[model samples]
Target chain A: MLEVLAERFNYAVIIVLMMVGLYAVIATGNLVKRLVGLSIFQTSVFLLYISVSKVFGGAPPIFDYKDLAYDKLDPNAIYSNPLPHVLILTAIVVGVATLSVGLALVVRIREAYGSIEDDTLAEADYSLELEKGV
Target chain B: MSASDITQYFDYIFMAMLLCIGIAVIRLRNLFAVVMLTGAYSLISAAWFVSLDAVDVGFTEAAVGAGISTVLLLGAMLLTSREADKTSLGRHAAAAVVTIAAGAGLFYALGDMPVYGDAASPANTGVGMEYVDLTAEQIVIPNVVTAVLASYRGFDTMGEVFVVFAAGLGVALLIGLGGSKREED
Candidate 1:
């Protein structure tokens, strides 16, 4: 029963992490906190992909002549799927780019508004908008 | 239920949880909460994609959904406010309902997807066979997915790179790249 329950435990863990991150993003009004939540959420998804790429009873794409037996191929070898890993590498690069851009935006926002709080910025922008007459 | 039956039920449960999370995300009163919920929604969707065996897509979803999107949203949140407009809830609900209905209809329309590992699948039977079979000689890459993404679909990858560059340029234009110089009145 335990084996069955844990058959796809990776998915379960990913889901839980996702929920926590989502909750954090929603519950926190602080800008940095929301970014943390987003990172958590994304990490879980990455885990899910890596886990799913695992093929049971397949050998790693790497070749080890010593591991190969004479008579018949070993049925127990498990080769992980490498495609998802490569895709994730690209995604990580993208994520870094996004992070730097976002941080830049935050800096600009801080410069424009003395405070970073959502309410304060809104009020400040509102007055500016008011000055412009809608 | 047998062990496999239990696993099947768990799948249903996961799907239910995903739907509930989606509802919670859209219903939340705070904008920050909503953005976070959106991340959760994407995470859950990534899990669902993994279950369907689209592992590469799952990876992309996880990174974009959780890591970068949340950061961008948080940054944007700092410039705005978290409080949901009290008067807009009704309109939001209407929009959500419409979106859900449309999405469901589209899903129903695509109901003939081949079952996992079907030998006769287009992926297994068509030109995919030649590619999969010839991987040893043609690309020498053991990973078919990599071959497809980097070589077969190379131009699409270029387009994606262009999109990212354009987005960066657009943001730079909005915020004014380099150290901000206080405008001389």
Candidate 2:
């Protein structure tokens, strides 16, 4: 039981973090808070990917050539998987791009409605529906 | 203990910090403080990534997550209100239920996963190793991640670039490109 716990503890923590983000996204009425929650959620997923790629005794994926001159390369040198690193690097940038776009939308919504709360926006829509008789 | 043992402890500490920050962000009503906390969370995450042997990813996370994202959120906050409106307990409870359900489902699935840091696991044994091995001969770049990103999976990156470009265009269209022009008009 202890062994399993030790092995899976990181995943457990990540799940808790993810749930917190989800709660914020769903429960918060503020648009900026929702985006912050979304970012937390995204970062947790990145942690998960980076965690999966880890090798117990691995070095960073950068190749070291210092050993090449002294002797033949050590055949057993371990490296953490580079593929996920590459993917997540791109993802982090893309996450920011999407975040900026979301914030821009929030700014525009505030300009149009004069409030950034989802409930306020919903109330406005509800009154509009009453006026439209729909 | 050993260096790896110390790193493991660091991993636990950073993860604990991340959880605390997540809770703090949810609990804080002041958006400015919350945004700053999120940036701190990202910075800690980057440090954790370094311990996990993902230096390149850590560098990008520090730059994009901690730096650019925080700046963007603060700029957005300037145009919106500072304090978040209070949410009803009923909505909080409903959200908690949904979050707990999702978390429990993932927890159940977690049992089937390979142990953390098992090099022989499917993920570590596959083409990830192939890229690490082939980068020297095929691309001659010391950094395997860069080689695979720029050469092996160039198309995927091209798509990501397009997505980023589209997002920038959307932001500019929604809010004017020049900040001064918006204020002037």
Candidate 3:
């Protein structure tokens, strides 16, 4: 048990962060707070991907351009795998876009219904439905 | 202490800080403080990413997570109340149950993942190694991440860029430049 825990401590931490974010998204009533939760949750997954891409003794995945040698592997270098980083770069941008849209929606929601709380918003909509007999 | 041990210690410290801040965000009713803490959480996690040999991802995380999202969230908050509506105990309980179950499921499955930072891990061995080894030879770029994102996966990046553009257009259509005109009249 101890060995398993030690080997994957980072995973455990990531999982805890994920759960916190999930709880925030699920439990929070405020729209903005829920979005914050969603951001936290998205970044946790980002960290998880970064963690997977790490190389134990790896350097950052950039070359020192001054040394303009040609073909062979540099014995001193252990570059971190760049695939996950590439995927995450795209993901980070998309996450920002998603947050922007979500916040815009929240702004419009506040304008449309005087309140951003889910329960209050639902109540207002429900009362509107009742009044309309639909 | 050895260098790796020290690095691991820092990792643990940052993870602990993240965990604490996450709890604080959940516990606090003031939405403003929670928003700020969320940014701090992003900043710290970005640092963690740097330590994991993912400097490129770390840079993007710092930029997107800490900077842009914080500013946007704060902008949105200006249009809403600062205090959050507290959730009922039963609702929170249900959320906790779901979160725990999800956490436990991930935890159990984690052992199957390649150990952290093993270069010989499955992800690093086949196509990934091919990309790394061939990227410089064929592309002549100093940064493998840039080459892969811009050249190899150019289509995906283009799609993402368009997604961002579309999202901006959507936000503009939803809120307008001056924000719903306030309608004070």
Task: For model 1, give the RMSD to the true fold.
Answer: 8.6
Among these predictions, the greatest DockQ belongs to 2
Best by lDDT: 2
Model 3: per-residue Cα lDDT over B1-120, one tens digit each? 111333566788899999999999989999889989989998999899888878888888899889999999998898888999879999999998999999899988988877766778
lDDT of 2 by residue, B1-185 (tens): 11233467788899889988999999999999999999999999999999999999999999999999999999999989899999999989999999999999998888777678888888889999999878776776678898999899999999999999999999999897987796787
A1-134 in candidate 2: lDDT tens per residue? 66675687788888888998999899999999999999999999999999889887788988776654444556788889999999999999999999999999999999999999999999998999999999
**Model 3 superposed RMSD (Cα):** 2.6
Cα deviation at B89, candidate 3, in Å, is 0.9
User: TM-score: which candidate is best?
Assistant: 2
What order do you get sorting by lDDT, best first? 2, 3, 1
* TM-score, predicted candidate 2 vs. hidden true structure: 0.95
Give me candidate 1's TM-score against the actual structure.
0.54
1 or 3, which is superior by lDDT?
3
| Model 2, docking class | medium
> Where does candidate 3 stray beyond 4 Å?
A69-76, B1-6, B179-185
Each model's number of backbone clashes?
7, 0, 0
Instruction: State iRMS for model 3.
Output: 2.0
Q: What does the lDDT come to for candidate 2?
A: 0.89
> DockQ, per-model, please?
0.10, 0.70, 0.70
- In the range A43-102, model 1's lDDT, one tens digit per residue, is 555655554454433333332434332323344433445455555545555554565565
